[model samples]
Target: MLSIRNLHASVDDTEILKGLSLEVGDGEVHAIMGVNGSGKSTLGHVLAGRPGYTETEGSVQMDGQDLLALEPEIRSREGLFLAFQYPVEVPGVTNLEFLKAAVEARANHRGEEPPNASEFLKQARALCDAVNLDQAFLRRGVNEGFSGGEKKRNELMQMMLLQPKVAILDETDSGLDIDALQVVADGVNGLRAPDRSFVVITHYQRLLNFIEPDYVHVLVGGRIVRSGDKSLALELEEKGYRWLEDEVA
Candidate 1:
């Protein structure tokens, strides 16, 4: 569903993603594991077309469309979702209002009628339950005053609602406890389908223990150095990135 070839991206004139190439097929979950400064999060930001993360070389195509050429909003409308490592708070916009607008925007982008208020509210409430969030949260500002774990779950809530074709989760497990982690993982697993693909970025293998990616890749020095099945994640947990760095060096 997503294809990236020799992608070189830069932030503030310093190069990060150097000749990175990755292919995410339909129904595949690819986990990118790396140490600090390996550019795992950079890959997600670059893929989502975040401002200032310029793609200096290579190509990214999502479902055959030129992904890098589209604006971030256009990318979201085109079924590309990026769950940030640190979810920002919108103080005045209630969660329900934000999600409803997003869902309606997506529907309008697809030339479909937006869901009625009652149906949308019902679905939103159901998703709150699914993510272990309180129904009361629907009335609060987006991620406002939420704990780290709550913010993470809020990201998953958005992911579930958007149902993007390619979802890039940038360390969604960063601050989650074990129980909260499982809930988030369950939400992600429930959305897995033959038409969906995922790019999960993290520094630890514990997240993979829950999500169980189809492929595990070790990203170092701004590019993917090794790619394997889930067993690779286990190996990383046992040995850490030192072994991979030695191999790359």
Candidate 2:
């Protein structure tokens, strides 16, 4: 569903992703494992067209369309979703209001009218229940005064509602306790379909225990240095990235 070729990205004139290339097919789940400063999150942000990160060279295509050529909103309208590692807090916008606006914006992009408020609420409530989010959360301001786990749950809620074809979750496991992590994983798994895909970027394999990605990739020094199946993740956990250093050397 997504293909990135020789992706070279930089920030402030310093390169972070150096000629990284990977492909994710529809219905496939891929895990990107890397240590800090390894450019995992940068890959996610660059794919989502976040501001400030420049793509020095590369091409990102989704289902054969030029992904990098579109604006951020265009990316979202085209069924791409990015679950931020740290969800931003918008104090004045209620969660329900924010979601409705987003859902309507996407619908408008498709030449469809926005769902009425009653219908929108019904759909939003169903999504909240699926993600185990409290109804009260819908009435609260977005991420304001929410706990770390709460923020992650909110991100999943948005993903569920958006129903993107390809979802890039960057470090969704961070700061989440066991119960919260399970909830988030269940929510993601529930969204899996024959035409949907996921790129799960994480540091540890614990999240893999739940999501069970079809392919596991080791990203090091701003590039993917290894690719294998789930067993590779267990091996990495046991032998560590030190083995990768030797292999690369």
Candidate 3:
């Protein structure tokens, strides 16, 4: 569903991603594991077309269309979703309002009219239930007073409601406890379908235990250096990333 080739990206004046390349097929989940400053987050930001990151070279394509050629909003509307590691808290915007606007925007992109209030609410309630979030959360400002885990759950809730074709989860497991992590994982697993794909960017291997990926990639020095199955994750966890550093060097 997504292909990135020789993607070199830099923020401000410093280069981050250097010739990163990967492919994610439909219905496949790929996990990107890397240490801090290894460009894992940069890859996600670049894919979503976030500002401050300049693509020095390479191409990112969704299906067969050039992804970097489109704007950020267009990327989201065109079935691309990125769940940030730190979800911003909008003081005045209720979660319901935010989600409705997103859902309507995506619907309009497909030449379909927005769902009416009743229909939208029904879908919202279903998504809320799927994420194990309460209806009360819908009435609150987006992540205003939410705990860390609550924020992650809210992010997953948005992903479930939007139903994007390719979802990029950037460190969704950072602050989640075991129970909360399972809830978020369940929400993600429920969204798995034949036409959907996922790129899960994380630091630890625990999340992989919940949502086993089709492939595990070790990203070092801004490039993918190793690719394997689930067992690779366990090996990385046990032996640490020294082997990856050696291989990349």
Give the least accurate 10-residue stretch of model 1, judged by summed lDDT: 46-55
Report the C-alpha lDDT of model 1 over 199-237, residue by residue, as the tens digit. 999999999989999999999999999999999999999
Model 2 steric clash pairs:
none
Instruction: Please say which candidate is ahead in lDDT: 2 or 3.
Output: 2
Model 1, total clashes: 0
Instruction: Name the lDDT value of residue 8 in candidate 1.
Output: 96
- The candidate 3 region of ten consecutive residues with least summed lDDT is 126-135
Candidate 2 TM-score, true structure as reference:
0.98
lDDT of 2 by residue, 195-236 (tens): 999999999999999999999999998999999999999999
Model 2, stretches more than 4 Å misplaced? Answer: none
What is the TM-score ranking, best to worst?
1, 2, 3
User: What local lDDT does model 3 show for residue 12?
Assistant: 96
Better by TM-score, candidate 2 or 1: 1
Residue 39's C-alpha lDDT in candidate 1?
A: 92
Stretches of model 1 off by over 4 angstroms after superposition: none
Per-model TM-score on C-alpha atoms: 0.99, 0.98, 0.98
